[model samples]
Target: MAVATGLKQEQVVAAAASDNALERLHALLTEDLRQVNALIISRMESPVPLIPQLAGYLIASGGKRLRPLLTLAAARLFGYQGDAHLLIATAVEFIHTATLLHDDVVDESDLRRGRESANSVWGNQASVLVGDFLFSRSFELMVETHSLEVLRILSRASAVIAEGEVLQLITSNDTATVEADYLRVIEGKTAELFAAACEVGAVIAGCDKQACAAMRDYGMALGMAFQIVDDVLDYSAVQAQLGKTVGDDFRAGKITMPILIAIAKGNEEERAFWNRTLERQEQEEGDLDHAIALLRQHDALDGAMDRAREWGERAIAALEHAPESVLKQALADVIAFCIERDY
Candidate 1:
């Protein structure tokens, strides 16, 4: 499909393939990102040593900061001039960091961003408490924006994210989960924050309702595409390039898109394998390899990637009418990057 600016899906993919789109965006928003980083560091401070110590570990860990970058770029796209975007961007990062801390604890994850996870280093209690502190700090930043609309968008996203996590917990290890259920889980957990982050930028910029809605749609679709690609990489990417082990999802019994598709396409024997490995959590030495084989045998990886690209197309389409600018083009290219990135 062609975007309002006449950019086609293939063109977006071609642009992403030719350049480091994310780096280009970071270069454009270098100053704003610097300010956002400074605000994050300043707000992370506290008299309690462990609070900052633990929170700082995860916050300073290598992350792309894509959500906050979206906020900054979106505001710039709409001609926002004031510093409110900085505070909102900082808040967006804090919220994302808090979710990471909590997710590590929930997932029993020992590593994050290729390093020891906060919960692994500091224990679950401390991680959970620091996550709470960051959540509170995020709200404080939102309040600083003084836009009730921004507060509403982010607060509701926070709640929805929690709900999504709970839903995932419910569906975990259950091979019967339909695609719709998985979509809802991701929409709440991941896409909601992305949507809120971009929408907050538009709202703070005093954009019209239609512009705000467009940004929200862009973010939500982008987030969906991003998470789907992430799930695909867990099974398809090389362990060295993937940052984490390739079979972490399999070990955890998480039912991602590849697994769901495999289950749907497999025969009775394959379903039995899933039951034994995922539902019962009785994985043997070569179970991961077997699982990977099943995925490939059924073309599950390709199927999931096709779904991701569909979301990427929707994301690009959402910004069809956005003013043609470097930032807008960067936003469009990032959709392709999210879908095409292997690591």
Candidate 2:
């Protein structure tokens, strides 16, 4: 399928293959990431076997470790020399993993990163408890940083992420949800953590207020673009490449950008279709296919992609005053990778 970005899926894949900005960033941060990984493994250990086992299942799962990487990269961009970024990065990953565990239970999802989700294998009770453990462990790591500012940033992000999840729950299955409500949900649940991750890096590095704000802006915009594109992919063939079930959002009756745009542009019949399948939760086998068709017919997917690109541009523009360096350029490239990645 052609993305709303005017690139065919094959073209998107080829472009991603050729440029591969994420790979470049990984190469730059190889040693730092290794230390972060080691710290993560050591911190996750506990006398309670289930805590480590369940947490390790998801932690060892094939995640990109993107959030923690952002923390490390942001610090390095300011020429930070301390090992504190390593601890902060590990703490960020724990927070993220904790959220994922809670999310799978809430979504009642069966798959995560293409495998059986922690909740699916370990059950909801175990998943929630382990998630709490991870959250507690994350705060412990944060306290070790000895920076009250870092604690405040990450703790506030944790609260905001919880708020965002609650907001999403409120909006889910409600076809009447507007674009603004959707943006609020994503900004709280998704963008806040990304913003905090980057901001914490700068805070620990003692960056000037202006520089700290710039990194925060870059992360927030990049996160918004990241999530918008992820929502778009739910109806795209590319979701399969990520080992996700296509139409999982539609199946769950979650009101995403494409659905919202389609409903706005749709005829009465189309609106009723949404009401029946989404609001009413009366999905039949072919409902997902028909929903995709409507999205295409109304150019809803294109509209959503357009919004994603707008956010991507904003992320890049936020870096205008950043010092020119290979790491800085790689960070900019990451914005494109977030928007254009096929898998």
What local distance difference test score does each model get?
A: 0.90, 0.89
Q: Write the per-residue lDDT of candidate 1 for residues 37-130, one digit (tens) a residue.
A: 9999999999999999998899888899999999998898888889999999999999999999999999999999889999999999999999
Clashes of each: 0, 0
Q: For candidate 2, write residues 86-124 as lDDT tens digits.
A: 999999999999999999999999998889999999999
TM-score for candidate 2: 0.94
Weakest 10 consecutive residues of candidate 2 by summed lDDT: 1-10
Q: Give each prediction's root-mean-square deviation over alpha carbons.
A: 4.6, 6.6
lDDT of 2 at 104: 97
Q: What would the TM-scores of all predictions be?
A: 0.94, 0.94
lDDT of 1 at 312: 92
